[model samples]
Target: MPAADWRASRLVPRRAAVSRAQVETVAGRALGAFGLVFGAQTVPTAVDQARFMADGSGVAMMAVVYGAIAALAAATFTRVAVRAAALAFAAIYVIALLAWPFLVVDAAGMAGRTPWLYYLCTVATTAAVIALPVAPAAAYTSAVPAIYGVVRLSPSGGGASALIAVLDTMYAVILGIVVLVIITMLRQAAIAVDAAQEAALERYDAVARRHATEIERVKVDALVHDSVLTTLLSAAASRTPAERALAARMAADAVRRLDEAAVEVPGLDDRVALTVLTRRLRGGVAGFSAPFIVRVDGTDGVELPVEAIDALSSAAMQAMVNSVQHADGPIGRVRRELEVRGVGAGGCVIRVIDNGSGFDPAAVPPSRLGLRVSIEERMVNEGGSARVESVPGEGTTVTLAWPAGVEGSGE
Candidate 1:
């Protein structure tokens, strides 16, 4: 299957993968909203019982309870102090329940119906679940409902029978326990998902680093085969003074290449100026057996890592060498140009173009390491990229870019 089709099929599964933090935020907000709705429903009952409450006690109770609920609602959206607000509401509700008899006008007058505070029993238990840890929340859930049951049986609490009080207490306890279990299960599942995701990412990073190390090894092996072994063979075959002199030059070049490779460690922090890189390229072009028209621009004041400088320099040189060896034709008919330009912050682009004999890039065999290992793989290992554009009998353009996408700066 194509990548687009596979992604389309995975859309629903990807959307279902919610993070732990997101689950907690949504649960907190939902509980806060529920608290607001439950608080609003108790307003009518509170007003009806106002005459039974003592002189400033009713107003004080309403202010504190309503204020805590409002703060919880605000905390849901702000994602700050949510536990504090829930704890305040739970504590204040329990205090008001305990002070009900003391604040009442007549204890015997409330012998008919339930107390106004009866409606908020479940709300208090739910708030406790949100505010406290599992063990404490379970304890609070049992204790608050039992307290309400005792209050319901008292004369000031409407003189309810034993059966009604027990039923009410059991209902609140069951609901609070159910909500606690559900929220706890959701949190555990989310935490497990987060851990799995973290582990997968760590494994992927380790694999990528290993792959990069393997590519670097292959590039170094190709360099040994192309430079050192070939130079040794040439020196062994030397039969005259001129041949020996040429062999000696090749041996010196091979030693220099090996020395450079020895110091090229991965993740090196050394830096060099853009001018230094351009100067090196210019000196290399001057030393090449075939001439090249070099053009440089925007190469002032930029600095790059030593690894990047080395990769770009080596790949650009290989591109030029390929042009000299394979693209050369008769006399001055072949025109070769090398362009280097500084691009996005601490980035650069280099291009080697040759109007010599061109061949199809697709026709190149895998046995040839000049374009693959020496140029393409080398740049990729350094966090850069290389592109070769060619057509039979026309021309070839090898464009190398550092830090990727910086080639757009030329446009």
Candidate 2:
């Protein structure tokens, strides 16, 4: 909307707003002080008889006109315009010296000769200019006239000049210290503003990244639900009774794994412990051979990334479903033993042994899609491999092994 509002919005806190205003005030004072110094030099040079003032009368008329103009500009204009008016006043003062230098140069007789009404007007105007936004600088420059008047009115040239010199020098020294302090404060304010702006930008960037990541997660989940989930449902619906038994078992296993995975946030993996896994499997693949031996034995304290655990769990569930459903004989004819053996290299082996009507794995066909996802693909994703061994009418066994904390490739 407005420039002021833009500054206010960025301020963020009330203290900052107040500090910024104070800084602006001080900067204007600095500008005004410089303006007064310029005027001090200009006034002396313009009136010197050594210069264009070879004729004195010309200076007075010029000074009078300049004074009137400077007064008007200073009084009517804003704080910024007061600077130009100060120099204008200096110009007018020099010109006035040609006719009325008595006002500035003579301290004792000024009130005696000047009309009372005119004197009041001069005082009011001078006070207003001196107190303008750059009052500090104006006060610094005013030291010149104060010193001149003290020297001019002194009974002894030595005492008065010495007193004026010392007082004026002290005033300048104090003024310089104050100006340097103000400059230091301004520099600090600039640095603070930069830091605040940088923090705001960083916060904005982080929020944007979080939002983008959430959107990507939703997209991936939607793809899984649409393609993989739909195929499982369709296959289950169209099977014969004997086939339907197997399909239902597979469907149940797939749904459980999907449900577990869905709970994980998009960037995290959803695996849990392997012991927790076998307990879950016994419920699904009912004909699993009894007393499965899972020997992490004493190495059971190992923890894994949730994602790797999730993939292994799903893979085991898929392999068991294959053993239970794909057999040519009844469920009672199936024999199975599932074991988890921990390895020394921060890895684990999942072995599924079964006695059932077995077929040549290669001739039986490319691995089923769920087996591809849960076994072969899952094992590879988890930094190991999967193998299926079978001899017809003898038995079948599938072993999937994986590294415990395989890092993602960032592909």
Candidate 3:
């Protein structure tokens, strides 16, 4: 495929996919807000029924139930303790239902009117759906409405007809089940998306590594054709001392080139000082179109495989280029930083950070080789890893680490 056509086909922007966590957050907040609205609607009924309750029990029930609902509503906007709020709303509503008969001043006097708790049955079940797992949520959904049904049959629960009570119970159960099914499906779909994305990334990484290997193989082949093959042809044709000496020199040059190629192969014993790697990184950063605040530390005497140095340097430079191209905004608006530091025995870590126009890492198209190929896969090919953290409009940080358990490496 033509390069532009290939990129155009694969690089088309995909609609940002929502993860499970994001789905849950939206569900929680929506349920909480709905619960609050339903709770508010119950206020007048609660006031009218307050007369039938025993001393202080009516006020206490209102306080506890309303307080829980209020907490649920408050949790809609804040991330703190959301599950706890949902649990409290569901559990408190159940407890209030169970205590209704005992709290009533005259059980029979409550006949013909629905209890305020009846308005919140669906709300409680919705909270349970948000707070618990499918099995437990289903159980809670069934049990809470059944409890309300029993309370409904009692005199304090308005002495409703069996048929009426059954209808109400079924209504709440069906609604709860509907909510449960919808939420469970959404979560399952989100999980599937996450799994698919992870698998695609793994496949892309493997393909990228294979591509790098093929390029190296081609380089070796080219070296053989240009150097070794030519030297052999020249040596075979030599008929004089001067010509033979020239052929011998050509053979020696080819041997040196072959030796260098072997050293360049990954996993070789050829080592370079950490300082050499850092120096290269510094030079690259200095040459960038925009200045980067560079910091280097603890790279004095450490040594690493030559392949590792090359991979790290290339990945780090690619990360910087990505920042400059994508993250850098107007002049003097963005602050870019590059840090190269040695860690453990001889491993190194590089970080490129920019306070500029950030982006969603998850939204990046697979065809963007600056990240998946030039940075991430390059590090993985060298037995290292890269992490990119960014939020749209917040900032971006790309961290590259070599030799995976570098923290605990012994001298």
Best by TM-score: 3
Model 3 lDDT per residue over 24-141, tens place? 7678878878888888899898988988999778888999999988888877545446778899889888899999988997876798888999889988998998889999999999
- Give each model's clash number: 0, 4, 0
lDDT of 2 by residue, 151-195 (tens): 323431122355554664455445544554555566467447544
Q: In angstroms, give how far residue 387 of model 2 lies from its true place.
A: 0.9
Question: Residue 182 error for model 1, in Å?
Answer: 1.6
Report how far residue 37 has shifted in candidate 3, in Å.
0.7
lDDT of each: 0.77, 0.48, 0.79
What ranges in model 3 sit over 4 Å off? 1-14, 268-411
Candidate 3: pairs in clash: none
Clashing pairs in 1: none
lDDT of 3: 0.79
Among residues 3 or more apart in sequence or in different chains, the pairs in candidate 2 whose N, CA or C atoms overlap within 3 Å are 269-307, 271-306, 271-309, 271-310
Assess candidate 2 and give its TM-score to the true structure: 0.30
Instruction: Indicate whether candidate 2 or candidate 3 has the larger TM-score.
Output: 3
Q: Against the hidden reference, what TM-scores do the models get?
A: 0.61, 0.30, 0.68
Candidate 1 lDDT over residue span 1-411, tens digit each:
122321110111112344455556667777788878888998887877777778878778888888888998897666566679888889998999899888888777787778877787777787787788889999998998899899888888888899999998899889889988987788788677656654543454345446656866887898899999999999999999999999999999999988777665355875667776676677666544456777777777777887898788878977876776556354345678888878755999999999765667898899999899989999999999999998755778999999877777645
